[model samples]
Target chain A: MTIQPAFQCERLCIDLPGAPGVRRIIEDLDLEVGRGQFVSILGGSGTGKTTLLRALAGLTSHSSGRAVYEGREVRSPVPGMAMVFQDYAHALLMWRTVRRNVALGVEGRLRNGELDQKVQNAIRMVGLERFRDEYPWRLSGGMQQRVQIARALAMEPSALLMDEPFGALDAMTKASLQDQLLAVQAETGATVLFVTHDIEEAIYLSNTIILLKGSPAHIARRITVDLPRPRDQIVTKELPEYLRLRHQLFEAFRHEIHA
Target chain B: MMTAVNAPAPAVAGGKERPWIFHAADNVWSALQGLLPLIALLLLWQMLGDSRSPYFPPPSTWAAALIDRTNSGDLIPAVLVTLQSVAAALILATSLGVGIGGLIGASPALARCLGPTLEFLRTLPPPTIVPVAALIIGVNETMKLFVIVFAALWPVLLNTTLGVRSLHPTLLEAARSLQLGVVARMTKIFLPALLPSILTGVRVAAPLAIIVSLLAEMLTLMPGLGALLLMAQRNFNAAEVFGLLTVVGSFGFILNAALAAFESWALMPQGRT
Candidate 1:
């Protein structure tokens, strides 16, 4: 039996209001994300990668074509999908404690004790049990981002859309968060559509990487990683397969820049 | 990395700390320090003033007059009447301001259309509005309320509108993605996010409400502290006039302090630090 795709979009186009008239941001794009798969869209700055992620999340309206989620049209945000934003400071409610921020997504749906349990479990999953009662503003940037992720996790979403969730963090924090995200994805089996400008990060975390290029950007290439699962940061990066993929991605990015 | 390497030394050796009682005493001492200037000024005035002078009665004479009024049951009633009017106006103003401001703030087109007219009306002085209100409502409780509400409403309305407009777009996105209904979105999201600004607006409006109510009472010869002050001044009762002035000033200060306390308490969850 063939498994159905979690999200599918065909000939998707988006036009934003600009200086003179409308400017096309995404043009004639086609993509599909499979169930329980980690897919990353890699592109340089101004390639509309974030816009495509927003479109998939139903936050932005496409100018034409259709975006379907499990055969249902996605015109607005659906309950079964959660988005993790890059700017955790603005995305996470500063007034709420770590556990309370995590509870934001599940508060209306869950009851008293059940809500508390889910919030605590989510916080523990992100290794923030000690900081659960503290405010988000008091924590470091990486911890704050974990709070946001824990919030998404508490929603019990079927799909997670992340827009460069760790782009602001330092190297050590970024590596640690990347590993944590992989572990969470493995445990939950949630389909992830991640947008990132980092090529190595895309290769490191994603099962499939979609390269976007050009003025009104469209998918230039799709590369699948057949590397073994339960990958390590030190061990995985040193692999011959990982090195080959990195070289290929570098060449592809350089080609797009030159073109 | 350098700081990280050196940070552990302090972490390992950190033991020196002050006792909780010392901290509490320090706070009390600092608060008392803030009142020293006012205490010194009052003492100097007491020493320099003449008890017999009609123009410059001593501080003791003002205290005696205050005690006399309190005993005769005039001052308390006058203060209660003024407080009641101000309180009523504030409730009305807050309700109208938040409602109208939220509506205008949510829509850019509405904000643009009403912006100029609201700006002009907001700049009109409270004394000017008091007479007009008296002319229309005839110097009653309703007229005093109208004047106070009109003067106090603008700060709240403008601040709330600006606050709502400046809310981070990501919050709205999160609310939408969570599939929150209108009521849930308002109470859980919008109101909590806009609370700090709303409290700031209330802080500004509270003082204005008291001042406007007092001004209205004095202008219309209404039975409040303002009228008492005017009557005392006209009768050349310097002690009573000064006492009433002190009372009014103290009342304004107390109201401001109460609102500030409320703001801090309500916003405590947000973590001021």
Candidate 2:
């Protein structure tokens, strides 16, 4: 017997309402994400990578075709699934302190002091223990984003959907958050569906990278990262194999830019 | 990356570093700007006017009569009655407005159904309906409350609806994705998003509530500051009348001070902008 994948999309088509009329974003897209896999969807500007992630999370409806989470059809946001929105400031409840914001997903659901325990653990995971009592608005942008991530983690989600989670950060913050994300992923082993336009980020984080291109976006390229686990920012990125992949992907990106 | 070491230790208890007394003082200064003309006029009246004048008694006589009223004990109770009614009406109006406005704002169908009726009623002055209220609810405190609440409800309701309409789409999406139920969504997501506008509405409605409370008391001859003023007027006690006006003005000042503190506390939890 075969293990069921975490997410499966068969001919998934998405049409978003544009100014002129209904515009197709993604059409006839097929994907199979195995359990605990880190799949990053990469695309240029205006590509439907984020839209695809939203569709998979059942945030936005697909025009046609089937998108499934685990064994169930994706109609609404599923249980055991959490999303970290790109705009952390807007996504987070500004009025809530760090602890309360992190506890949002599991606030009333957990019992017997489990809720507090989960909130504390998630805050600790994101290294925001010192700022737990402070409002998200008081924190720096990167810290605010960490609160968003902690909020998702508190859910103890089986599958996590992230849309350019570190896109807005400075280089140092981005690098640190990337490693922290990897550490959390190693510990939790949650299936991650990440969306980004950064080639290096996609290469570093994902087990599989799905490059989306064109207006009615389709899977233009699918690249698999066979790099060893415990990937490092300094060491893994400097490896000969990693360098080779980087050179090839950049060339593909250059061709993409002109085409 | 431990960047929080220099993260500017934000004052946790108070949103601002300034003392609350000073904060209230600052707000009082701005509020007093509009009343400067009245204050100047009163100072002039005190400097030139005689104490025996029936129409333009000196400020000193106003104070004397107020002290007399205080000694007789009618002043404190009347003030308390007026204050209580204003507080109660405000709470009721805010509750009704936020609840109903949130519902209407959340649903286009409901907003459409009620929009026309609300427009018609909100514009028709609450005082004009005083006779209708008296005929139906009778000349009681309930009728007074109903009229005040009706007057004050509009600002909060309309502001809330606008707030909900302009609410960040991403925030709604986030709430939906989190699977928050209707009640939770309102209290946590909707309330905070609409808070600034809600506060704006309440600020506009507060004075209106106070004035309407006074109006109802005067019109119905109920036991409040308004009725006290009416009695003094009928009895031809010009000193008491001027004194009561001064007392009302002082009470308004105190309430404004209280409002400053309340606004600071309520809005301090977090700020969107």
Candidate 3:
């Protein structure tokens, strides 16, 4: 028997309310994400990448077509699926402590000791154990993003949807967080659909990259990275294959821009 | 990263641990500092006023009149009646305001529909309602309560509506994504988020409630401090009039302080540091 895909979208389209009537932000698009696979949706600023991610998470309603998760129609947010937003500061509950924020997804479902254990485990996974008692506002931007990730992790979702999770972070912080995210994905073995505008980030993190282009965007290209497991930042970037993939992604983006 | 290290510690939890007594002493010292200006003003009043004047009495004469009223057991009961009325009105107004405000705020259509009506009602002087209430309900506790509620309900309702309307959309999304039920959404998310604004409305309303209650009492010749003040004024008992006014001022000050303390205690958990 064959295993089903984690998420499948068929001709998904999104029309957001605009001043002049409904505006199409996402055109008919089809994609499938396998379990335990790390896929990055790369696009320019207005290419509807985030909209696609949101639609997959069931946070956005598709104007046409369907988004199916594990054979279930995703009309609304489903259980066992978590999302990490880009604006971590607003995404996190500043009133809550780090542990409380992490526990937000699971507190209502889990019991006392089990809840604490899960919260601690998630925080530990994100290397934020020491800051558990601190408030989100007290933490750094990168730390705040980590707390958000920890919150998503505590849900123990089958699939994690992230929309440019490290887009707002400093370059150094962004690099470190990218590696941390890789470690997390490897440990949990959960399917990840990461949305980012950065070509290099998409190349570095994704096993499969879906490039979105055009007005009311649709998938323009799909490339698979066959790089070795446990990828290193410094070492992998120096490799010939990694460099070639990066160049190809750059060319794809440039072509999209020019076209 | 560098900003995080140099950021000031959270005011709620940071700093060296101090004994309970030290904190209490700090509160007491601050309270004394607040009272300093009042004390100075009273001293100036005593130095300037003539004891024998019918229009203006000295501090000693006012003190004597207060003692006389207290000895007769009239002052305490009057103060109690006024306080009870204000307290009852405030409780009723708060519940109604929050409930109505939440409903109106949650629906933009309802808010827009009722906006003009609410604004018109709010603009009508609260004291104007006192006589109307007295005429309709008769001179009684009900009349005072009606006046107070009519007068004070607007601020709390308006503030709560504004707060609810301004709630972060992302927070609502977060709540929905977590699959929070309606009850949990209201109690855990909506209520706490709307609390600061609710308290602000209550603060404004509390003083208004007291003022309206006093106004109702004076206008209708009801039993309260307001009635006593009006009676003293009629009798030309300057000392007694001044003494009652001073008591009313103190009540206002105490109410304000108590509400402020409650606001801090309730909001501290939300990390306003």
lDDT of each: 0.87, 0.88, 0.86
Model 3 regions more than 4 Å off = A1-3, A255-259, B1-35
Q: Best candidate per TM-score, number?
A: 1
DockQ of 3: 0.55
Candidate 3's error at B48, in angstroms? Answer: 3.4
Per residue, candidate 2 scores C-alpha lDDT tens digits across B182-235 of 889878888877888898888888889888988888888899999999999998
- Give candidate 1 regions above 4 Å deviation: A255-259, B1-32
Chain A only: list TM-scores of all candidates. 0.97, 0.97, 0.96
Ranking by lDDT: 2, 1, 3
- Model 3 C-alpha lDDT per residue in residues A1-259, reported as the tens digit of each score: 5656999999988989979998899888999988889999998888899889888888889889989999999988999999898888777877678998898778888899999998999999999988888878777999999999999999998899998999999999999999999999999999999999988888889999999988888888999998887988898888898999989988877866686
Top model by lDDT, which number?
2
Model 2: CA > 4 A from native: A1-3, A255-259, B1-44, B71-73, B271-273
Q: Which candidate should be chosen as best, given DockQ against the real structure?
A: 2
